[model samples]
Target: MTMKKLGFAGVMIVALVGLSLATQAQVKKGKTRPLTTKQMMAGLVKPQCAGLGEALKAAPSDDKAWEELATKAALLNESGYSLMDDGRCPDGVWASACKNLQTASAAVLAKIEAKDYAGAQAEFKGVTASCGECHKAHKK
Candidate 1:
């Protein structure tokens, strides 16, 4: 092979290797430890709930934020479904609490989409109450 062609090939190989390493590093960085039930509840679920609440509170005047919040609520509802279906909340009391939260979230989302802010706010309060009730019953 010509010297210039060999040099170019070497550069290409180095570029490819660098790209591979970069992707692997990114995957590693993105890897998260599997969350315990409480961690999942506290770290993932509760924040989503709070985001929903904040979004709803602000949505009255900010249509864009309201839509974003509604999306977050929907995502949180999906997460709750996974938690329930996976039997993650094995304690009967905790399971019941999760169930209630799921119900309240659904109701709240429906109200929000219907532009019934009042109803959504009420249901949001219920959702938070359900969380508290579950914690009281099952949290150590």
Candidate 2:
């Protein structure tokens, strides 16, 4: 019943999906064709998250991997905001979770920027954990 009990990621996703009917009528994030939020989730968010995972698997000494992770983090950060835009979080915990996700993604970027491999790995895990938390609650 409560946001905490509901799981921020899951509740946020459900909230986003609940708004799909409204978004479906409009062009997807200013695309040529219309797309439901669910479609975007499948098309945009999922692959990008996978890319993030791949970046995480890269060797720490791999500069190219860190670069890829930075790029993926930026994209994922935007995707996170896009998932629940206009501050449409379901509740306080949901909002906090969303913010933490965004922040974690940024941390990923920052760690890569500083060439802090260990920090980047930890942040990558943090990002993954947030996604898992939400998916557990909402992903079908």
lDDT leader: 1
lDDT of 1 by residue, 1-140 (tens): 65577698788987899877654433222224454565666777878887888766644666775677678678777766656653344457666776787888888889878878788888888788887887686555
RMSD of 1: 14.7
Candidate 2 C-alpha lDDT tens digits along 1-140: 77788898979888998777444433233234354556766887677778777756655567776677777788878877765664334444445556777888889889888988778778877777777766564454
Which segments of model 1 are wrong by more than 4 Å? 1-33
lDDT agreement with native, every candidate: 0.70, 0.69
Model 2's lDDT to the true fold? 0.69
lDDT of 2 at 55: 59
Alpha-carbon deviation at 17 in model 1, angstroms: 51
Best by TM-score: 1
